[model samples]
Target: MPVPLIWLIAALALAGAEVLTGDLFLLMLSGGALAAAASSWLLALPVWVDGLVFLLVSVLLLVGVRPAIKRRMQSGKGLLDPAKALEGKSALVLDRVARHEGQVKLDGEIWTARPHVETDVYEAGDQVTVVHIDGATAVVAKIV
Candidate 1:
């Protein structure tokens, strides 16, 4: 059996496992196997070189690509709770805002607002950054 054929079989098996796992990790390994097979067939590289290529490609995909892929896959989830998603948003103060009192337009809706710092005061039209959300109120700080 040709080495490339063996690599192709491994790639197929890994990809099949990926289908069951749905986590993309096995898919990355499948990609590495495919590359190894291609290198073996096209370059006619030595066995050690083909194995090295497979290992290097797999490591690269796992370390560099996997995290970004996971982030892209996870983005915009957990919408049922707004706390983690709403933090760090910018808002426009629509009313005088001080400790425990104010209103701001956040995400196209007005929300009760308060300064994150007790001494901070924000006037109408001030741009503020949402630091935290306490129940229905947004804690804001003036944008530097």
Candidate 2:
């Protein structure tokens, strides 16, 4: 069989395994194999070069793309909880935010906010960093 055909067969097998495993890992490898098949068809590269390409593409997908895909799949809603996702994000104080109570415009929506530290306070228009989500409130620290 041709090199490209072999790679395509490998990709098909990987995809089938992915279906059975229900994990995206094999899907990523399948994507790499597909890429290798394309390279082999277009460039007629040597077997060793095709192998290197497969490895590089597979590693990139596994390391860089898999986490985001997995997170989306696992979150069910396609995203993490808003509060958890907003951790460490910047917000603009819309009201005097003290340790007890206040409001801030976080990612365009107003949220009940509190200072992360007892002494920290934020006046309207000040920038703050979201420290964490405490119940429905955002615990924030001044950006300094």
How much lDDT does candidate 2 score? 0.92
Query: TM-score for all predictions?
Result: 0.53, 0.53
State the displacement of the C-alpha of residue 117, model 2, in Å, after optimal TM-score superposition: 46
For the record, the alpha-carbon RMSD of candidate 2 to the native fold, in angstroms, is 10.8
lDDT score at residue 77, model 1, on the 0-100 scale: 52
lDDT by residue for model 2 over 57-110, one digit each (tens)?
999999999999988878786556867889999999999998787999999899
lDDT for every model?
Answer: 0.93, 0.92
